[model samples]
Target: MEKNAAELLKKYLSGQCTPEEKAMVEDWYLQLPFQKKAPAAEQIEASHDEVLDRLKQRPKTRGIGYLKHIAVAASILLCVGLGFVLFNRKIEPMAGLAKKKLEDVLPGGNKATLTLADGSVVDLDKALNGEITKQNGIVIRKTENGQLEYIIQDDPDAVSGTNTIATPRGGQYQVSLPDGTKVWLNAASSLTYSYPFAKNERAVALQGEAYFEVAKDKQRPFKVRANQQIVEVLGTHFNVNAYSDEPMQKTTLLEGAVKVVAGGNEVRLKPDEQAKFNAASTELVVDKNIDPDQYIAWKNEVFAFNNEDLKSVMRQISRWYDIDVAYKGKITTEKYFGEIPRSANLAEVFKILELNHVHVQVSGKTMTITGN
Candidate 1:
């Protein structure tokens, strides 16, 4: 037990630690009970003399077990200070929150709309899990797993036509292109591609965010155009986030290679690299040693935030939960780092935020951040 560690724990208990310090203290404290080697009493005495003296006054029968009980009590106090109540070994809303009975919004799921070449719209959510439509020799079907797939049949008379698949707010969808490329569209995103890819190129226009597993075709390169930026690759696994509301467009490579071009500026990316394109400055910058999982976590049914700002986190929440967000007064500048399951209901997600001292008021489809 170092002096610094004791000080950090004290700050965390009193809710006076910084965001980074809070995260560190919580992580360490949660694992303290299960640590293989507990610190010696002498170490505690050296760091926190008052705590050791208080422990010594207790009965000998309550030795290490008494310390464990103290740890549990401290944890409970920490939880309460952070607006959480421990119930049956689970974290739940405080009594005040429970009494409010806030309206719970369900999480997003497989939902999208498919626009045919003829401008006909098909709601994928209501469409049957079978042949959705047949255009020329291309057979579009909705799989049982809620994936929209295209099967190309050999037809000499087949002609290429443009088709678009879009996911509305609180929705997401997966699609397999005519060229066998797999795409996972995030909430409020769209992907437009040719029914039968042109002979010399396979191109798609993307809006919002999508993760792509491009099919290999040496003769025809795969290109994704998003927010005035283009990502070109023969075959690669990558993710692109080009939401209009976001400050910058991001392209992260997971495998193979990709060349991101924007405003006549270009940068080639290797695996584990991310290219950030700023539309305002028309500058394309590459970040090395990036973690691709964080960018693609949404596709895997999780919301991963790595030192993200509160506004950015709320934007993702608004899109996925189909809600509008507004802020009042000054908000905390603390950066958040964690993951929340996409399956969690709105109330559950807000509870997590409350644990971080973010106060939110939910009214129908809108959420207002009152304070922190």
Candidate 2:
């Protein structure tokens, strides 16, 4: 590859490239010669050495695996890289993250508490798979696959009741709204909606993070109230991150269209676009260049961080692991670029951090971080 192309890839990895530049670099990456079949063990080592040697020719950076070009290339080469490693070595790609038996923290699953308008709470995790309850002529059932779904009866006399489903730390859940919209909540998140959606509009209150695959209803626009922003869409797939600890609330659209309103401003977002709302200002900035997969990866049971900072990564870890994080030194400024399965234990997560010069010490459920 030409030096210019490498430089462009570096920019793309760091999330500094424009939409046009990102597309160009992605095209160039696809054109690279990748192995079609799994190579022998000897060929595996040779390819690894070749990749390492090429990486060594690049400028060194502060953090390990934090090399700008290398990390960028690694993400693009993930399919080819992991396929080779798995087919040849028959080992986990991230062999470094050994299971931490002593302090193993499993990933979050379909766990949440559903609160009815009458103030009755149902533990979705323990509740048997079937009709859990009935409110306002809406039948709430726990599906065999561990999903909470609502079936609205055709009774015109059906009442409307607001219900809330909350996922605790180290827990997550999925629910189908009465309007047939599917929502997947992440750990430490909640979604509140009326059992029978209003005839005029469909609205839901949200906290933390959630992914939505809204059912098409052009007559009544679907609106989500998350933090200080409101996302309105007719029918679309989107992900919203409104965690209180996060610096900014992000609304990323994956399909169709949506209008995000924050403060006194409103911006329309297209597919693959994201709207960021800062707490300090009312200005809603719409970023045309974005990767929706990184935002919704949590719903898919993976932790995907693209040019994410150490503190940001830890926030997700702390919530998912249900652990506390304390900083021993000024290391939150470090940036990481990679993906890891959320199923990994706490110790395994720490191992990945260590590779990036982040030293983590876990005691019980508390984790302390220090600079390397």
Candidate 3:
């Protein structure tokens, strides 16, 4: 079977293969069988090194004709080599792959709580669209898209009231503050602000993650307080990640400029810059010329990972799925590179992770990371 498959693949690579023969080779590759037992780490590492050395020895060519051969070889080698890498990492073949469907957990959606100044809490998820309540002569309505919007009324005596919106784990929400500033609160986040804005400044306190589009009001500076850090802006776009569990708080600027104050330090950020604040340190580290889109990708319902480690990736999964994560032993430091749609179920996500040699067991709302 190996000899026949190799012959077919070789013919296909030569560009002289028939359509039926090409299809046969593709089918064989796609159905490559998984080994019942995993290979040792050293053996897998040797295979990986061997593949790299062989590829590096191949003669370089600028001719387009050589491109197809290189592509074919690279594709086939990656599949076979990656399989070995995964097997070695796990130290055991995947189990319950076919039985992971006992129950699948769905992703988060727009759900939050709206706390009025009177200390009344309304569940936005259960509230009907339009006219949830009225306070300080301002009308609060739940939009058709599950967003919370404010409508200011004409009342000279009306005093601006404070309100808070909070999203629990497995939830998200968007809101248009009384000053027209737009905010998207990520899962396990909250935003608190005074409605109708005060005369001097507009401020909001945030916990967890949020993307903000500050309504340009040069007269009133927009300030967001996330823990001990404060980001002051004058009509700009930015994202703030202040999850309590995270090691550092990050404020990324997408447009305009902002002054970040944290840990007895301050920095003015330009466009496409990220300021990181560690509570233990008295300095703000700013990363310039970064892709701000990566910071705000969650607002678009995408889990974007760029060479992220397993623990960091799982942290996001835990919040989005509202599941507890436990490692059977020492956690893996393996890095992953890929993007997964936020709409995928927990089972679907685990299936992809399994390809990377990550073994997991899901029971109720708990996920045990058994290996790799």
Compare the candidates by TM-score and give the number of the best one: 3
- Per-residue lDDT tens digits of candidate 1, residues 292-363? 788898998888765566899899999999999999877866554456788978766665555434566666
Segments of candidate 2 deviating more than 4 angstroms: 1-102
Q: Each candidate: RMSD to true structure?
A: 10.5, 10.8, 8.8
Ranking by TM-score: 3, 1, 2
Show where candidate 1 strays beyond 4 Å: 1-103, 355-357
Candidate 3 vs. true structure, TM-score:
0.77
**How many angstroms is residue 187 displaced in model 3 relative to the true structure, after the best TM-score fit?**
0.2
What lDDT tens digits, residue by residue, belong to model 3 across residues 34-150?
A: 222323334433454555565466442111122222323222343322221221122232357433642368898988999999999999999999999988889999999889999
Question: Which model is ahead, 2 or 3, in terms of TM-score?
Answer: 3
| Candidate 1 to native Cα RMSD, angstroms | 10.5
**Location of the lowest summed lDDT over 10 successive residues in candidate 2:** 83-92
Comparison by TM-score, 1 against 3, better one? 3
